[model samples]
Target: MADGTTDQGPVTMLATPISLDFEFTPGVAQSKFLRGLERGEFLGQRCGTCGQVYVPSRGTCPTDGVATTEDVVLGNSGTVTTYCVVNVPFAGQAIEIPYICAQILLDGANLSFMGLLQEIPTDQIRMGMRVEAVWVDEAELIPSLASVKYFRPNGEPDADYDTYKEYL
Candidate 1:
């Protein structure tokens, strides 16, 4: 110990190395959804009471507050309901910042799903722009949304904002 200072050894201690390991046991609903993704399909559960559909296959419906059992496949193409330009970098994000992240309403489905936008100018990304899923190659199939790489403009005319405004 110093003359007038108390015995405060080190300012900081060394941090322990971290190792993360865990197995995910998917529930029946989640297992089915994952299997569908491996087959290049988008699966959602439908509410029998109100006919509302949820992507990622929720076991319950938010609208009617009831359990769902019906499985529906959402189409690949849809209209962009809304979006935000991500100008900040994030850990584990594949693309750089200044890219657009959008909510798309797939055809034949009543809900929207969030995805990345590409193959178009960021400035040209507007609400209601028609976009389609860009799936990863068959050899890269995985039980995750990342199986679909991203969404891209389909060269279709943009719909009016009012058309999908309520979905936002």
Candidate 2:
């Protein structure tokens, strides 16, 4: 009151509760890719102009902005372009502590995709390491990348950087 003003000691605010529900559908390009995963197939779409193949195709070429139409079936094997060892623990992680998360480029595809790297010691994993997909039991599979449980060492020599350097 000395400054001719009164101040409130504190203010209480109320928060409204919210409830929500959602359903989703993967569009045309991704739908086809997911369907292929259901049967352990690595399907990619090819851009007619640039001849670049894209796995989990978005139905368009990022390089040329052309519609990708040709269906290309890539092998399960690929090269690990890069990776990181995840030693930190987080809730809801299905794998054990200290696993690898990597970007793998399938043999015929131009882009790399992120996936779990398993079945080998983290110390043994490296760039250009060859790997192959390991699948879940057929009975347990759905149209998703989850069907490919993880990537494992393919017992092949590591690829030269020249083979996958562009992807890095």
Candidate 3:
């Protein structure tokens, strides 16, 4: 008891698990986006003023502060604008360490959204890397982003810096 050192080298504490439930209302624009996901469609809303598109839109444009009513169907493919390798492990994480989490700029959309990148080595991940969504089985899909499992390389040429510089 007098000595500061102990036989145990380190101590690891597991987090206490808990459950929470709540009901959420996906407003007009968001509802539309979710419905699109249910049907295997990648949908975004364009600002009536700036023409900027947003996925899973918040019902209004951040820049123009105007309602985004126009439904724009976007493709599953996109470019990686920026990313980080998840080297640290955490409690309840299902993915293995050293995964790539990148901000993908989907085709024809002005804004970028975060997505998991896989199928390519982490060492080879870089900005402007072309990628495509890996969707779940048709029957398993639902009105959620989870429909898209993850993204993988599409074997396409990298996008030029000029194309995604502003987003970075």
Per-prediction CA RMSD (Å): 5.2, 7.4, 5.1
Winner by TM-score: 3
**Per-residue lDDT of candidate 2, residues 1-168 (tens digit):** 455334654447776778688877888889999989998889999999999899989999998998898999999999999999999988668888799999999999999999899989899899999999999998877898889999999999999999999999
Candidates arranged by lDDT, highest first: 3, 2, 1
In order of listing, the candidates' clash counts read 0, 0, 0
lDDT values, one for every candidate:
0.86, 0.91, 0.92
Give model 3 RMSD, 1 decimal.
Answer: 5.1
Q: Please give, for residues 41-122, the per-residue lDDT of candidate 1 as tens digits.
A: 8888889999877777668888788888999887889999989998888767878778999999887777788999998888
Please write out the lDDT profile of model 3 over residues 35-92, one tens digit for every residue. 8988888899999999888986888999988888899999889999999999999987
TM-score of each predicted structure versus truth:
0.82, 0.86, 0.88
Query: For model 3, where is the 10-residue window of minimal lDDT?
Result: 1-10
In candidate 3, position 16 carries an lDDT of: 77
Q: In model 2, which range of ten residues has the least summed lDDT?
A: 1-10
Off by over 4 Å in 3: 1-19
